[model samples]
Target: METSLRYTSNSRSLKIHAKEKLLVNSRTRLQLHGELDTGTGAPSYFCAMIRYFNPEALTILGLGLHYNKREKLRCLVRGKMEFPVRTGVPVTFNVKGRCDFDQEFNQRNPKGAAEFAWSVMNFQEDQSVRLKVGYEIFEKVPYMQIRENNWTLNANMKGRWNLRYDL
Candidate 1:
């Protein structure tokens, strides 16, 4: 379990987050995560997921909720798969997708985005240094109030390297 409260100087808001994981057998686990922001109109998010692991792969399915100050709520469905690659070095590949819907479960206005992403991570022999590369595409919701039928498509590719050390 983990919990944190942070104050944002620029936004002058307090953000709270909590996460917990439970073992539901030898190969299954449940995770719960939630976040809230005290900034006006900011949305609060909650997610619950169950993960299943086997010798070769891991799979996760989750449901999420987003609630705003106006009392409007949106629902999200997410799924992910991770597997180890047999490359000479230690590597893992991950694929994930998410679908968003409005309060009425319609993929329209105010909350309609579909995203698909994939990533590959390479780890050092000691597992302290890692490199990751990922790409994602989004069927995004329009920013302007032109029409409910208008939508946008976007894509992004990113890479990052990190070094970890224990104190």
Candidate 2:
């Protein structure tokens, strides 16, 4: 089966595509490939965590930073894993990012700005997933600094799957 999922965080967003080739050896595994995009303007950071279901237990994998020019900070992650059951499966992941822009106007009085983002995902029993993301920004001068600005996002995702057989 082949499926695709997407997520948007505070400073980053990702799309995950997966394909299930066969059910054999009493096990089923999916191959996953995904791309992540970082927000524009200023320096942005990206990070993510992936979880898989296995007979032994739930396994977690972490991904580092990936960048692309045309996409303006694009990242790719790929892997394979097996699921315990074919019934409704649950998965969870998290992504985070930070951006900072600071320039020195003088020796003591410098301009500084920073932005931070965090996201979470939860897959339920109905083949639907819930997502949440939050962002915050702060700007400062040598003597004074502005209050931090914060924002949040909430979303639900539905995935489509296709199955293939080989003998």
Model 1 lDDT tens row, 36-144: 6767545466766665656454666666565555446667676777666654546566666777678877664332222222222332333333333444435332211
- How well is each residue in 1-167 modelled by candidate 2, as lDDT tens digits? 44444344432444443433433233343333333233333223332323233446433232323333433333333333333333343322222222322222121211222222222232233332223222212221111111112222333222222221211
lDDT, residue 108, candidate 2 = 23
Cα RMSD of predicted structure 2 = 15.4
Question: In candidate 1, which residue ranges exceed 4 Å CA deviation?
Answer: 4-14, 38-43, 50-55, 64-71, 108-127, 139-167
TM-score of each: 0.52, 0.22
Q: What residue pairs clash in candidate 1, if any at all?
A: none
Total residue pair clashes for candidate 1 = 0
Q: So what's the TM-score on candidate 2?
A: 0.22
Alpha carbon lDDT of each predicted model: 0.51, 0.29
Clashing pairs in 2: 1-162, 68-74
